[model samples]
Target: MPDLAYYASLPRTRGAAAALLLDDLGRVLLVKPTYKQGWFLPGGVIEAGESPLTACVRECQEELGLTPRLTGLVCVDWAPPRDGVDAVNVFVFGGSITAAEIAAVRLPPEELSDHVMAAPEKVPELAPAHIARRMGPSLRGLAEGRALYLEDGRETPFG
Candidate 1:
């Protein structure tokens, strides 16, 4: 195994996000962020002293306004820091929601402006570099109910 500590030393702390996978007739749910205008899964950082699982669930509810059935954690991505920022560890949880319930979800104005559903093959056009890399693999593992290990130091899986 690679030296996880080498990468861990680059960032002082970890930030978490939930990659909410809403399976819609073989399609997945994604959001186009207002600030960045790129495709991304629904999730946000874990608050101070908050559990990753709790934060994942809360973020989905707050951002999308839908209570999804969180199946399991599909992937863990480490994004090394650029400039003086901290590295990010995004915990993508596999989940499911209904198409009818999709319309009921609401996006926070500061975080996002709109949402869309796309086949996995079309994900590259919408996702940020970090996220785009893992979208397909993560979705596959999530669908299969297996955890995908993304412990690569050279690759970034979330932006």
Candidate 2:
């Protein structure tokens, strides 16, 4: 368990986001937070009374300048150890948009610097630490499909 005292003292924030995974064929969507200046999946804090899915769609429009139909919830992560903040819950949804659409996107400096599709192996360089960690197993699961989910986010040791 984390330090509840510190967590309770800090303000809680709710956010929604989507992860657009594309191949190195020059495609994918990611955002750079102005406060942290790190490459992260596109999405932002949910508005005071917005649904998570709605917020995710809105964030994709605002950050990537494209409308994405979220296909599935890939991962829900709880990030820790950022200043006094208790946790940052990240909701990752799988979706796709045309490369032509991404080319037309104009990102504001506050949200994203640029969006590009890169090779899956290169993701570690672009993804934030917490995000990268969460993605590691998820990607494997994506490749393995239902067989992977049978364990529910666990890793089996290799001989």
Candidate 3:
């Protein structure tokens, strides 16, 4: 068995969780982070001792100011390391937002800059490449009541 120091020295991948929220018009909700260049799903990095689902719910409440009841897993994407950044495993959950909930959204200016309800087709234009690539499969998975496993945002034969 590995010693505690050995285990602690092992490489660890980052984990993040996001919500795939939709409105009555079937438009997806996207948020622009003040720290990033492109739009992204409503979520953030998973904290210590936090499950993916719990992180998703907590992030949604913190970012959108609404505690939505997330339904099911939509996608689990493994983004390979790039530009010296550690690899990240992203878990996405599906949920719907009512008009009232949408109206109640309040972004913390220090974190998020803006939010938009964009048609599914427009997601690719607004989000980062990885996020855009993951959107279609995620949506399909949601509609089929199944979850997708993706590598670098593309579905693979094996997880």
Candidate 4:
């Protein structure tokens, strides 16, 4: 077994979960957070001992005030450390919401300012570069009906 010091020396990565929710017209649902500069998906950091999917569902409920029936894992992206932040492993899940659900969305004024259903191409304009980069692989995963693994939001050739 490894020593405690050896274990402590290993690099630590944070886990975050986000859902790629789409409307009937296939527009992506994006949220504008009051606390952040750019728009983001309806999800947040994983809590202690919580699974990524659990965090995704919980965030959706908290952010949008409704429980979403997530289709499945779309892509898992390993984001490199940047902007003085630690590395993060982001799990993106895919789901579709109805018009009723859209009507039911209630954003907490302190956490979020607004929400919009944007075409996929507009994602780059709304979100940060890192987040925008993930959309391609995530959408491809949803379309292909398979999960994908990515690094810095780009799919790798090797398994």
Candidate 5:
């Protein structure tokens, strides 16, 4: 009755943005959420009216207490629907942290209970499979200076 057809025609999807924050030592930043099980990147769900890149920076500040100087796109993943949930579009951006930025870390206690700076090789063991797959390639792409289009975590020709 109230434009139900219009709503039905719209794509049902969610979006999130994450920062691939690397230190001078080439370690990646990981945050432990009190509400979640495994370690994840310094990022969260993108809010409506917010651009993906901007959401990445915002989440970093909210979670880590430092305004990361985000640079290039790392990888964009199109994750299919799971458990009847809408599909998700995840964007990861590469950002390097200065010593000053590291010094400014003041994690929000209520959200994050712990943090880790892990070597590249250890990211897979640190995060869940979906994230692990993405992080490895993201770190590589950051170093190789290229961005990738991915489905879930694997780089595929089709998105």
Candidate 6:
């Protein structure tokens, strides 16, 4: 087995930034990628040397054509490794958009096929299992005013 030191020295996992965006009606916004079957939150892979926060903001603008000002980080999920891919570090941030902002949103044709504003209670059902697990807890963390750590989308220690 590899030593702790060896593990510590391993390559850092790739990461992505996700935004939990809410509207005046308190509905959460989720996006459907043109390339995928399921809906997802506003997010994308973090580019080299870019901060997670910056990535979230950039992705929102790219995906939804809105300049989101994220309030704070709500969750940091260390997604389980899969299919030769290293574990993904997912960062979820809290944000909101005004009615005008919502009206101004222009979905990027190449990235998204559709976008929905689901009621808070319906978000879990709209997303996949992994996304649901993290989003549920992350929204709670946003409501309670704290950050939540997660592993495979489940709440983790040092939260």
Candidate 6: regions farther than 4 A off: 1-9
lDDT (10s digit) by residue, model 2, range 45-123: 7787887778788887787777775556655555554667555556666666666666787787865566666566676
* Per-residue lDDT over 22-111 for candidate 3, one digit per residue giving the tens place of the 0 to 100 score: 888989999999987999999989999999999999999999998976789988999998779789999999989988888899999999
Worst 10 residues of 5 by lDDT: 150-159
TM per candidate: 0.82, 0.71, 0.94, 0.92, 0.88, 0.88
lDDT of 4 by residue, 15-133 (tens): 99999998999899999999879988899999988999999999999999999888999999999999898888999999999988998899989999999999999999999998999
| Candidate 1 residue 141 C-alpha distance from true site, Å | 1.5
Clashes of each: 3, 1, 0, 0, 0, 0
Which of the two, 1 or 2, has more TM-score? 1
| Cα lDDT tens digits for candidate 1, 1-159 | 989989868835677867556666767789877777588888878888888888888888888887678889887777667548578777888888787778787888888898888888888777766677878668767878876667422223441
lDDT of each: 0.76, 0.61, 0.92, 0.91, 0.86, 0.86
C-alpha RMSD by candidate, in order: 6.0, 6.5, 1.6, 1.8, 2.8, 4.1
- Count backbone clashes in candidate 6: 0
| 130: Cα error in model 5, Å | 0.6
Name every residue pair that clashes in candidate 4: none
- After TM-score superposition, the amount by which residue 109's alpha carbon in candidate 5 deviates from its true location, in angstroms, is 1.6
Model 1, TM vs. native: 0.82
Considering lDDT, which of the candidate structures 1 and 2 is the better prediction for this target?
Answer: 1
**Pick by lDDT: 2 or 4, better one:** 4
- Tell me the TM-score of model 4: 0.92
What local lDDT score does residue 157 receive in model 3, on the 0 to 100 scale?
92
* Predicted candidate 1, C-alpha RMSD: 6.0
Displacement of residue 52 (Cα, Å) in model 3 is: 0.5
Judge candidate 1 at residue 75 and give its lDDT. 78
TM-score of predicted structure 6: 0.88
